[model samples]
Target: MASRGFIELLRLADMARARKNGRQGGQESDWQGIVFEIGGQRLVAPMGEVSEVLTMPEYTSMPLVQPWMLGIANIRGRLLPLTDLSQFLHVPSRLSQMSQRKVIVIDHDSVFSGILVDQVLGIEHFNRSQYRSEAIDSKSPFAPYNHGKFFKDEQDWFVFMPSLLAQDSRYIDAAI
Candidate 1:
């Protein structure tokens, strides 16, 4: 009986060791984000800031709202206001790409809404080591909500913070 108990303890120790190793390896890819195309630019939203991504859904147009506001959509029994990111940023979008728009839902703290983007390029796992925080161009509209950027695959993926966007008065005040 003592020998069997010893074996069980050894197995437990091995499992613990494996788990620790696994966690340590994951540190290299500490940051993950959902990459999407918006306004002819590739942007990435932090994984933690986005709840889910869904295809365009039917929504009722609301009168007396900003043109950027695509109105409210019924998402899983919850009303989610969909906003056109391109319109809000005043960025020009390719007309051909407009048909592939996807909704990126963000639900946190005081914000629960979906922002429409040109395309959802899937989740990207990036190492924090590749991050860059240099100041963005002064005239860039996205500069306000972009925290920094992650350089990967020979491209700069701006880390978009929907939380920051949510805090913007221009974004929240939708009434025309």
Candidate 2:
């Protein structure tokens, strides 16, 4: 009887360890990514990691700045650089009637920056398994930005890694 109880305990422990591993491995984990609107595009981000999202505000332009740099904006009295991700993604900046403009605040390695977008859609959740490795066709202008693809209905959703986007040479001031 003691041997049987020991085996049962061992099985329970094994199951517990599996559950812990799944949670820590970032798969079917409690946390999920978020999807938002940027211009005509819908972007998915790992929710809480994004600091804030606001309406497009007046910004003070910097001389000789990159085209994607929409200048600086005062947020709650703090100055933050605003980037036009649409332009950075090489997409056109024209606004349409349905466009909902907003600024997406992001942080990387404690450095904070905001992205100007044409709209703020909403959020979405998915298991990490939902994403699969895939190649972007040469015809896609978004080819360079795609990290991998997921799905929703008949549409294929592309997932862009935040670290890659944050570390883009365009966003970092090379001179500094």
Candidate number achieving the greatest TM-score relative to the actual structure: 1
lDDT of each: 0.79, 0.62
Supply the global lDDT for candidate 2: 0.62
Clash totals for all candidate models = 0, 4
User: Candidate 2: RMSD over Cα atoms?
Assistant: 12.9
Tens digit per residue, CA lDDT, model 1, 68-127 = 998998876889999998899999766555447878888878889889888877656678
Q: Candidate 2's residue-wise lDDT over 1-176, tens digit each? A: 33133223433454566667673322344334445555455656665556666667788888787777778888778788888777777776557431246676777785678877676455444555666678456576556656676665666666555656677675677222
What TM-score goes with each of the models? 0.81, 0.68
